[model samples]
Target: MKRRTVLRGLAGSAGSIMTIPALAQDRYPERPIRLVVAFSAGGPTDLMARRLAERLGAHLGQSVVVENKTGAAGTIGATEVARARPDGYTLIVAVSSSHAIAATLMRRPTFDPVKDYAGVAVLGTVPMALAVHPSFPARTLQDFLRVAQDAPEGLSYGTSGAGGIAHLSGELFQREARGIKLTPVHYRGASTALQDLLANNIPIVMDTMASIAEPYRGGQVRILATFAEQRSPYLPDLPTAREQGLPGVVSNTYNAVLAPAGTPASVLATLNGAVRTALADPTMQAFMASNLVDPFPDPTPERTMVFIRSELEKWRPVVQATGLSME
Candidate 1:
């Protein structure tokens, strides 16, 4: 009888242990959650974070607060998220520049992109536009390549900054365009680069569609091609580099959500579900459209990790070719 009683106690203990995860998930997000944006407020990353926070709060039954921790090319915010408690309360807005590109560009990486965090979901991707001054003599991507091939040093392209994805895109373009080379000019930001392009000082500028949207729509700048695997839905008429015969010259700035490593699987599932629901909302879709971001077709966490890994591999050689590194 005593042995039976002891066995029953053991069974009960085991069952309770298994129930702990369920109970923890149920009680999760008991308080306000903090979403860290690794960029300045009002930037694209911050905007995405705020938008997700609003919908995530509703889905999780808790308030989601956004905090800006901008610095070190977005490493400051990412480091904080990596070191944060692995309880799902603290999360980060992960971007390709900070999470993937930084790993190869920075002299000393503070965190491991793949190991320090659990990917929640990929929010979306922002494609880069290759724009030029209307009078620069290249109306289409083919025309531009011909001109570049004819006079490799005659054409010059500008990017947002050194060691950025846009800069790397230009590098990749130069390498893949087949005997075509263009001088790279670094600017403070895309807006400044676009300004130069408008002034006819710089013939080409590769920047995000959002950054150059106003100029492109205003007819001040002409976009030759987009650096994406597929054409951007925002501008379907525009041709992608892949379609233009530059197969591997694709560049996209994607944003994702990640929690500190070791976050419970149950909590990760809850967070991923909340993000998926939020992304499907009509309001969210409208916002993303306005911001020039395309919703990721498959946002599962596993896919996000795979995408990040691929991005890291894709940019490593490009960054190395540029021979640039950030302190």
Candidate 2:
């Protein structure tokens, strides 16, 4: 009798659970939503977040604001989201650096990237190209590798930080190519590294497309190859490193949406729908193109989580192998 009673109780609970989504879909975002960007304002990630905020607010009939809470390689912003109310009002749009390296970088992070947040959607990846000052004399990936292999001190590459995606990608390239030894020069920001690269203080830099495009077009730098799987539409002449024989050289900075863990599943679905709508808007699409960011496909919750997990696994070894840490 007790067993039957328990089974009936379980059926009742499952039926009620099914109704929650219907209830949530009817009325959500009773207040304005906050989208937090882990980095400072005016960068690619920030721009995307702000654009998303405007579109998302329009779709949801509420004001969505983007707040910058930059620090400690995105831990400051992530921690704030992790501790937020989980009422679906607060969201974080972040890159791989925050999700993959924060735990390993910090001596003690306030929150676990995976445990503290639910992966909402991976916006899209921004390609990082291997560029060298035009005066360096390397016109192709092979030529650049050959020179680095021959150099006794190894070739120096500049990146934004010690454990950043750029730093890890540089180390990955070094290991994959085998012959070349790469010495990383960490900078406070891409702009600083770019300044040094322009001055020829650093001959090479593995930097984002947005950062290096102007200089490359201005004849200050030459792009050997982009880290994307295929040649970029914006730079068709430049080959990918993978096509140049280093198949493992695929690297990009991916941005995604994350909400505090245990947020209602209904809220997650709503946010995912909003992301898809925002990314597809013609004006937003034009903005992304101008910025060299590709809009991601299928912003489903499952796909987003799978992509983040894959990225985390992909970079974990590179981080450990390179001995990169925030400390």
Candidate 3:
């Protein structure tokens, strides 16, 4: 055969071989799917992941087991999933901390959130609250701002960690609340922060509603404002920061499902469709609302990527302002 004909035959064979895996994905996820959560088993992230696992497993006809590989503010488990095979068997249940805030906040990152993962579904978001010691003398968000602005020194607030979403959200809030600035006093966890706030060791604490819901209800701490766009169901009488004065200071941590970057488009479609269906279930919707987890209107993969990118951009200024860097 001529040289051109031989080259054509070799190219065709290569193309055929390359298409095998993509074609095989038509019957994808034959075995159990591993959903990795980068936090402990009881936290909001883990809870969300487990709920999603049940929904996804029901739809996909496979047990979606949740495995916790906790550490690094959600980068450890994320790294494991980023290195996983792209056969749709391994996925990461990533939060805004890992995918957005940490992507820009951490100086030493384990993986690239945008490059190493493909969006499967945008799970949901939980708005944060700015809580204060009950005796701090602020009845509302505007009152708190006035007190903070008039303070002799920088008012300090507590957060779960330095580079986590809580800290970044606090920083963002400080930036938006002109003439009023609050410094973060980082702790090992939200419980510790709450303890400090209760003891009046710290005047303020910023954390997700899941962490502070009980405290706020029990009157242990006064929620000055929520970062939600509207009223929280749990605190219907309470107004959001936007409702008070600062309109651009809303912040929340969200969960998004992602697969290894090279996963087949067909496999991704299967996973996304299953996730959308699961989240749409009335039971899931009720659960999410009660838990303060708001579902995305459009959770498609394309929209998910755009949302992730926007989150990264949104937190970049906060990171720059706070000068936070995690090990």
Q: Which one is best on TM-score? A: 1
lDDT of 3 by residue, 1-327 (tens): 699999999999999999887677877778999999998998877888888889889998999999999977778888899999888999988888788876676677778888888989888878888999889989998889889989978799999988778888888898898787688899998889989998999989999887888878899989888898787665687788899988997888888999999888899999999999999888888778778786676888888888888888888887877766777
lDDT of 1 by residue, 3-83 (tens): 999999999999999998778778897899999999999888988899999999999999999999999889999899999
Score candidate 1 by TM-score against the native.
0.94
Query: Where does candidate 2 have its weakest 10-residue lDDT segment?
Result: 318-327
If scored against the real structure, what TM-score would every candidate get?
0.94, 0.89, 0.88
Error of 1 at 197 (Å): 1.2
Q: Is candidate 1 or candidate 3 better by TM-score?
A: 1
RMSD to true structure for each model, in Å: 2.0, 3.7, 2.9
Q: What global local distance difference test value does model 1 have?
A: 0.88
Error of 2 at 191 (Å): 1.5
Clash tally, candidates in order = 0, 0, 0
* Stronger candidate by lDDT (1 vs 2): 1
Which residue ranges in model 3 land beyond 4 Å of their true spot? 1-19
Sorting all predicted structures by TM-score, with the top scorer first, yields 1, 2, 3
Candidate 2 C-alpha lDDT tens digits along 140-179? 9999888987899898999987777778889889988997
Off by over 4 Å in 2: 1-25
